[model samples]
Target: MEEETRLSRLKILKDIAELLNKGTDTRAVLSEVLKNLLNVTGLQTGWIFLVDQTGGYQLAAHENLPPALTLNQCAPMCSGECWCLDRYLDGRLDKATNIIECKRLEDAVDFHWGETYGLTHHATVPLKAAEENFGLLNIGSPNKTHFNKEELALLESVALQIGTAIKRINLTQREQDLALTAERNRLARDLHDSVNQLLFSLSLTARGGKERSEDPEVKETFSYIQDMAQEALNEMRALIWQLRPRGLENGLVSALKSYGEMLGLKMDIKVKGVINLPGSVEEAIWRIGQEALGNCKKHSSQEAVTMYFTAKEQEVIMDINDEGCGFFYDEEKELPSLGLRSMKDRTEALKGHFSLKSEPGKGTKIRISIPV
Candidate 1:
């Protein structure tokens, strides 16, 4: 009988390993694993939290949660602090172990939030790969309060698999991002060396022809061509800058100020914290800033803009403001016309916040907040 139990556990581990290795989408992988884990192990309930460096967490996956815990569409699971998260933030939860009765479940029981279904306690484990700690895995059963050595071992092993899978996914994503960046650099160089140069030459040639022409109509035509070519050249340059940001290494604020000036705007820049940021954060900021300033130049009709930058341990914020001819639109309407959608997409890619407030004659302000 003992030999049969060991073989079954081994099979479960093998099956889980296969599941973890099968997918690129983090949430999808975790959801499937959590469901199967509970079914095979006889545990009735489980969940996983994917936490960021800022100590913010997302409930990545859950299984067989009782109605009380699942009340209001899992609002109980989504909000507020609990013992596991507190220990995780404080660095005390280092391994698989039984924790005190779950505070969340306790609250639900005391407040009559829902049926507890006999659940009172849970086992918690830190999900980590080497020195990089990701988050926590929690599992429990009806009327189960204490976890035995065998239970702890299973939790530990499963947590190890989950953490390693997360690390591998992150590395794979990094490699793909690096490859995409390299390709962008090559494309930017090619455009700058060929089409960009041609546009510059065309603009200059038109200007020269305008000067040398005797006919007013011919000069006017030359002037129109010159203007079109110069506008196209400026647009191309902006695209190149997006493809390969040149000045972000100095710092985000400095690069932004330089970019704003390049757009022919007087830059009033104010920064509140020591400027330090990762490359990914900086890239997202630069791209979003570029779009905001471009919108100002094209629609705001204002020559001066203000940029406010603030950095903190958990979050960084940027505000772009222009006291120009702002316009109003229906909030429900799609806003792709002014590059707002593109900017929003870039900010959200970093799990950031994007908000815009504008009214006719009231100016425009775009605020972006991103976690570090």
Candidate 2:
């Protein structure tokens, strides 16, 4: 029991720390806390009540509360309401712990709120950091007298950790967004002013030189330069497209098609797909494909590769199969090269599924799927 309790605290602290590092918004932070709370307590129902702008707590995560409480149909806490919070706010209940007895609960606050709502026994703990009361954490049970003093004390500790962690997550999310935005802008401008302009000029030069060059060698040289310039421009444009914080609104089809066409010269690649996923999802897959194809050209001894993209209502899938000599998948036999790691990171960063299948003498196949 002691070990379980300690691990729970550590896990909550670690997750909250991660959340703070991620820089998610307030609601998202709270949702994560609620999820952890559910895991720690193993309660049948629960809810998080956050202090709204109205100076009273509003229901944020009411797992099994009635539609009224769960959806927050009722606004700020009111005096004499039967809700458990009424007792807490009235100072008739203990603030040091969160668990409350169902039978002992008293308030004109609408006892029916619990009786009809299917919550018999539950605990209401104040989510406080230092001395400031930020919110209420409610854990419910269908059976009477389910929560005890000891459980409430543990919950109090959990609440303290949650409050601080949520604040950190919000701060981190803001900082991360600001940093990403700044980096994206810097990269976008660099490509536009330098690489983009050069490619445009070269394309025009190659076309213009065609009429002026009477020498066959000179014409071929200009043609090759033009081709190289066009390819470079396409890639630069793709990078620019990715640099857009808004992401690829054109969806996976457009992203893959553009990427494949841009890469056709260096590698024999075929891409086919039709999708309209969120910009983030599309960008993730596009980047993964880019990294995978780059690997094919750099390391894979294959003549050609084909990428099949498909999306249904719930999932978006991609298959990159190459006829090149494949490597061993076992860690003991082979370590993940930098290129493979990059591919995995791209998928994981988007919270998607990434898998690789390969063996000596056989070809390699990369399969990835993300929720749409």
- Model 2 regions lying over 4 Å from their true place: 1-161, 167-171, 178-186, 203-235, 245-247, 265-283, 297-305, 309-316, 324-336, 349-353, 359-362, 370-372
The TM-score that candidate 1 achieves is 0.92
Cα lDDT of model 2 by residue, 236-286, tens digit: 876775675333455554555555555552333444455567656766777
Q: For candidate 2, which ten residues in a row score worst on lDDT?
A: 70-79
Instruction: Please give, for residues 329-358, the per-residue lDDT of candidate 1 as tens digits.
Output: 566777747489989888888889988888
Which pairs of residues collide in model 1? none
Candidate 2 at 268: error in angstroms?
13
Best by TM-score: 1
**Residue 236 of candidate 1: its Cα lDDT?**
92
Alpha-carbon local distance difference test for all models: 0.90, 0.66
